[model samples]
Target chain A: MQETPRIRMLLGLADDALIHGHRLSEWTGHAPTLEEELALANIALDLIGQARALYQATGLPEDDLAYLRDPHQFRNVLIAELPNGDFAFTIARLLLVATAADLAWRDAATSDDSDLPAIAAMARNEIAYHIRHAADWLIRLGDGTEESHRRSQNALDALWPYTGELTVGIDRSAWLGAIEAVLERATLTHPADGWMQGGGRDGRHTEHLGHLLAEMQILPRSHPGATW
Target chain B: MTNTPLWEVFVRARNGLAHKHVGSVHAADATMALQAARDVYTRRGEGLSLWVVPSNAIVASDPTDREMLFEPTGSKIYRHPTFYEVPEEVGHM
Candidate 1:
């Protein structure tokens, strides 16, 4: 079957949101404090919401797109599936992704495409909070206790490999150039080329994704059409 | 490893309005308390101003004393001017 370019692009977005939301949800009941737990949960919910909107627009049920797919079918980059290593690591990951996602969505919200702009606008406000919160924690953790500083730096180093594919914008997508320009304006430093990793978008996932899907999909797959 | 105390949240929705009780959250300190309150309470833009008080520092009136403390204000009928008749041109009165 010939895949439409729109479906493929939308799949990339939904997959990214699904994988990252699953990763963030791992911090639930285990964050450094009650406030942090709530924050992570709220961010996860927003990502899930974005994924649902994108998936539904792409002509698929969000549940089927999120839970029914096999691990090999997922197009999310490898970084989103990596395990949450520590509090600092989690914050660091959030800092990086939220900053980039925030930039990308800002451009998306202003795109020539009608529906895409509206969806991106709605997502931008929530993503702003996610970026600020994560960046605040990054500064605190990076400058705080000896342990915290070390952990965050290590997290950045570890996650540095997957940064490249995130910026590999789809050539046919009109918003790519604008989004890249906005992200560049932020002046956030990504690691050098030798350090940048790959394989998430190619459907080559990390070892972590299987376990992540098994757990995230269990309830929905088992229930099959259950709704609140 | 950090044991930050809980904080009480109060929100002021508009400039002329009084700050009212909201809820509480545990934070590393007061600054973080304010940030957390903003994230948790104002995510939907519910507030224009916020105050974070350490949970331990708040003093309270007894719940059992509610009638004695609040009833007196309600019983003062003369506090309101129900009997007054206003002239037609006195619009606000």
Candidate 2:
């Protein structure tokens, strides 16, 4: 069957959620506090839920799509696959990605495609909370003590370059404006536009994604054709 | 951090119901406390609403004063709903 642009878009969104959700789940036991650990894990579960719905919409078994796909077949943007560095880095990355996702899902909720719009509508409420959670952390960490402020600023600067890839082929003004407003309130500086990294949407990714996929795919691959 | 305050959580299971104390979580502020409550106490779809208040805000009668505070109610059998009998035709009432 010929794939529609809608299917491609759905795949991109799903892959982004799946990969980032995996990274977020990695913090299950290691977060700064028990409350934070639960919060991050909850957010991770929400993303994975979104991914499962998107995968099901494609008329394939969700597990097959998630666990059997090749690395190059993924369509998530570059930002979603980056390493979770410090807590500051994770917050910075989430703030940027969740903001973009909130905008994208808000638009997708009204899309002409049947499954995409319904899935988007169902997922929008969850994404809204994710955005708020990330935004709250960003503001707190950025405006916090001297060490926190320094670390947050560094994370923002380091991750800023990858964000441009998210803006491609989408109306970026809303995303940029939302991010600017948060940065302003948080007292964090936005990096000036310069050289921007690209290519994850085209199946080219950093080494981090490959390592992540290896761990995630191990169980399913080791037990091919086995069902619980 | 240990310095973070503890907040007691209450969850309302449905509309027209009172929020009942469920558990406690630690957070730096009310906003984080609310988020923590939603994440911890409501994960099983157990709530229609949530409230988180700082633990210190609550004033409880001393445990040593249990007899003074609560023991008297136990002996008041007349206060029990079963103490009165309704005709069978009254059914639910």
Candidate 3:
């Protein structure tokens, strides 16, 4: 409820995980295969778990923060709110965000000996797995077939602009290098950097966040204090 | 579904423990099989290590040979380690 520099940082982390996890959850019943269905769901759960911990660290009720926030109140980066395009697109998106999340959480865990650091320590391990899963898929799709290569490359280029917002407290060069190595291994060309889009960090966001929140918040808003 | 082969999974609960057969996962390669096994079988820290083998690679005993192959072994009680005298210090093998 109260805004502080530290709380805003926590919100940024929580919102990114929450929105990205929500987007991933959309693939629950529709992933390409049974193994991928389970894999994607597990990754989504890990991300939501990370969001829960970060929100809890803010000393606000995590549910209230999640379900009661307005569209403008969300601080998740723009790339996270984008729709899951195709299988290759989702994997590409995962590769990008998971890499950033892994680095960000690692830095946070090592930054201080506080409650946020403890949450970050646990989150860092889970996100390490996310990074590996995404990287593995990126390679498979990027190098697998002619169609897959085109799709994977397109996904990276499309999502590249929104990544500019992720570097507020993150190391841009480290993130870029890590991503570049994976892209190189995947045999996917790196998109040229250009006019980087931003905003969600300062509460400005794409139109998608409103629709996402509308669906995500409806049950809580409609029912108020009711619980099963 | 397109040539993604099935692999049988085995997971070790901890160091010094055997990797018991867990289940199967479908993957295009050995590396993906391991990742799939980790995702499907070991979500709750249930394993210290994992192994995935192509399901087709495993050779299984024929059910019809059970009596011929295993019946004699059932009668061979002398193979049991119970024949050895245990020193008290050795304790609980």
Candidate 4:
């Protein structure tokens, strides 16, 4: 049987959340401050929760989708799987992705598909905070001391090229406008439009994804059928 | 930085109730304090409302003065509501 567009879309959303949530979880003990550690962990939990809901909607066990799939089989955006280089880099990626997610889920909340609207409704709320938190950090880091300002600008420049891939089918203007507003408030100059990268949606990913999956799937693959 | 101020967090578990102290978190400002409080103290839906007050803003009495502040009230039994018994029919009182 062929996969329905609905299932494919749901899988994409689930993969995005799961991969990004895994990245965010890496900051658990490593955030700059104790408060930030908790904040990141909470956001990670929210994303993972969204992924689980999205997966469950497809009538598949979330663990199987998360832990059993090979890297090439996953449907997340390349940006979601990118290595978090530094605090500023993570914030930059997070701000971009959260903005897209906030907009995506906002529309999904009204989806006609089964379970998606309800799942999206709850996810929309969590992603709203994720946007707020990321935007807050963006502003603070972008407008803060010289070192912070430089790092924030550099992070944006490095990550900006990957953002074009995020708006392939979705309405790009709204996401662009929202991001521009945040950038303006942060006193940061937007990077010039340049070459864009794609292919994560097509099952093509960067080298980092393989390493991420290796760590994420190690236990599950090593001990198949093992129950906690 | 370590010098960031700490804010005490309080949560009102439900409507028509007072906020009770839950914990504290370090924040550079009140907005971040509230955000941290929400992230740290309310993850389990344990609050209907939140209050974040800077630790420095609080004027707590010295613990050493507890005897002078509270012990004297203990012997003032007349101030107690249990001093007088209600009739058996007044079950609630």
In terms of DockQ, which candidate is strongest? Answer: 2
lDDT of 2 by residue, B1-93 (tens): 999999999999999999999989998889988998998889899999999989999998889999898999998887877866799998895
- Rank by DockQ (best first): 2, 4, 3, 1
DockQ of each: 0.38, 0.82, 0.68, 0.78
TM-score of model 4, chain A?
Answer: 0.96
My TM-score estimates for the predictions, one after another, are: 0.80, 0.96, 0.92, 0.95
lDDT of 4 at A205: 93
Question: What would the per-residue lDDT of candidate 4 be over residues A114-169, giving only the tens digit for each residue?
Answer: 89889988888888899898898889889888998899999889888888878766
lDDT by residue for model 1 (B12-87), tens: 9998999998999888767778878876887676889999999889999999999999999997888898878889
- lDDT tens digits, residues B15-51, model 4? 9999999989998888888988998888899999999
In order, what is each prediction's RMSD in angstroms? 5.3, 1.5, 2.3, 1.5
lDDT of 1 by residue, A16-53 (tens): 88789888888887887767777888899889888888
A1-228 in candidate 3: lDDT tens per residue?
788988898999999999999999999899888888889999899889989988888889999999999988898999999989999889988988888887887888777736778888788788888889999889988998999999999998898888788776788899999998998989998777789998898888889899999999999999998799
Q: What is the lDDT for A155 in model 3? A: 91
* Cα deviation of A120, candidate 4, in Å: 0.7
Better of 1 and 3 by DockQ: 3
Evaluated at residue B14, the lDDT of candidate 3 is: 91
Report how far off residue A24 is in candidate 3 (Å): 1.2
**Deviation of model 1 at A11, angstroms:** 1.5
lDDT of candidate 4 at residue A203, scale 0 to 100: 83
Residue A208 lDDT (model 1): 89
Cand. 3 Cα-lDDT = 0.89
